[model samples]
Target: MDTSRARRGSDFARLSRRVAEAGLLERRPGYYAIRIGLVGALFAGSWAVFAAVGDSWWQLPVAVLLAVAFAQVTLLAHDLAHGQICRSRRTARTAGLLVGNLAVGLSYGWWMDKHTRHHANPNHEEHDPDVAPDILLWSRGQAETARGLPRLIGRHQAWLFFPLLTLEGVNLKVSSFRALRRPSLKNRAAEALLLVGHVVAYLGALFAVLPPAKALAVLVVHQACYGVYLGCTFAPNHKGMPVLTAQDELDFLRRQVLTSRNVSGGRLLDVALGGLNHQIEHHLFPGMPSVNLRRAKPIVRDYCRSLGVDYVECGLLASWGQALRHLHDVGQPLRAARRA
Candidate 1:
């Protein structure tokens, strides 16, 4: 390890000790109960509205509400994957299957495999799938060597970012299906079955209740809102933060903290993002409950400051601006290459 890595390891050890001493690692069952309760209520309410709307124009607004509810439930699924809610690994996997595969049509097995790697090596170009090369160029190296459609998209990615987010729901569903085809996924059969059931129940109900045109419109609205809401919540977490390469030797604390950007806001923002506004703390302690992240934030921030590590936290709007600026900056070289 490098000198910085060594220092970070030492700092993390101290921080861990302080956190333990302060009892910050203890589970809060009541908080989680309240959160799960509210999420369940929202999902129920949204579905009830959808069922009541039938073929009326009110279906569009109901679809939007349902999309928001789905996004919120997804956050709970994220927590399940981290074992924050269900401490038992077996129980957590069960919860993940129910929430991710059954409820949201995402494969829990695939998500666990990808998310575990991300937690272990966040922002790493070679290891973290979140930052892996795609149609959008998020790094200078990726932009400089882009070709064909990717090159064209990279040139105008900043402008296209939000528009493209509208398709993220479809992208995620496709990714889940693709993941099921991989031989390495252990629970492939179960996951595939649950996803099929979810599709049948979800679309079957829509088509059964409404005309084909109305059903299509509701699908579009729901997916668009779901994608955009999820994208908005995730974009600020790491988009403008530091990117790690395969060669970096940073310790766990440094790796996660340096690559994560926290959004600053009060309880409203906290609830909106499912406590992900405390990105740095969440990354560092992935198993910690979402409700506890706020309390841990000041402790983690102060510890990092004392160690001279950069801990980025900014207002929500500023964080979004930073992400857009970074995307624009990365696209500049691609645009110049196209011009040439």
Candidate 2:
């Protein structure tokens, strides 16, 4: 039952040799320039919705819908920071920080640092530092063993995944503040100022322009929409990939592609994910503009075949199930020694 497909090729070896000669894929500034105009349009449109909601009969529905789109824009900010949507590092970080803090209420510096780590060591147990304290492993003879409440939560992540994703704003605030506090006094002062400034600015706008209750309602709606948008877009990738040991670059690249399957055939999914659904190609060339991902798919598939690595590409429904299965798998126990 397992031997009929064409034998896999040494696509990986060819890819590696090509990479050695051509270097890692880079982002093109043209992608960033065009997207900058698009982001501006999105930002303006969201603001128009915000303004119109205050006066129109369609207030509630429009607010809810636009809130969802605003959250998607937050993801755009993230991609920008990674230089995925943009080519210039300075432009990426500047745009990410501005939009992240203002539109999504997250600390840009903190998120960049943490997310950078996640990209460097996705699914790693020790080196990645992104895994929650309780993720389980099924290596060696301990494949079927269960752990504790952490195990339970990992196994049944669907219930908890929503809450965690929704509270991302709060999580970012707390974690970023904590990280800020750990640095020098000067840095701590700057962080405090930024925190206070963020709050004052938003609260001032709410109180000055809208009724207190209405302002609170708007904030609640905005955050909820943002959370839903985040989880749906991100969980599809790397949730089911192999957990890491040491931080080896090649191994990390392999896990990213092999574990992160793509969701196909939907324009909405591609737009919503900011084109991240082309996960394999994206992993291979993180800095490349996402518009090219679809075009690069066959190139990536060919490369993977030559390398004898599995390129897991699937449709949305199957990808979602795979993500759930990953959650279930995470409920087991770790085989590696705990880091001291």
By lDDT, who's the top model here? 1
lDDT tens readout by residue for model 2, 1-340:
3242222223345564555354345555676567666766776786676675563344455556655666666767667766776556776666665676655556677777777777766666665555645333322222345456544554455456666676665556667667666553233454455666766876675556567777777666656666666667766766666665554434444766765677786667777688888877777666656776777777778777766777887777677787667665454333222221
Top TM-score hit: 1
Task: Name the regions of candidate 2 deviating beyond 4 angstroms.
Answer: 1-13, 16-27, 55-59, 84-88, 134-155, 184-196, 246-253, 332-340
How far in Å is the alpha carbon of 209 misplaced in model 1? Answer: 1.4
lDDT of 1 by residue, 16-101 (tens): 88877877788778988998899999988888878887779889989889898999999999998888886698888888898898
Q: What's the CA error at residue 240 for candidate 2, in Å?
A: 2.1
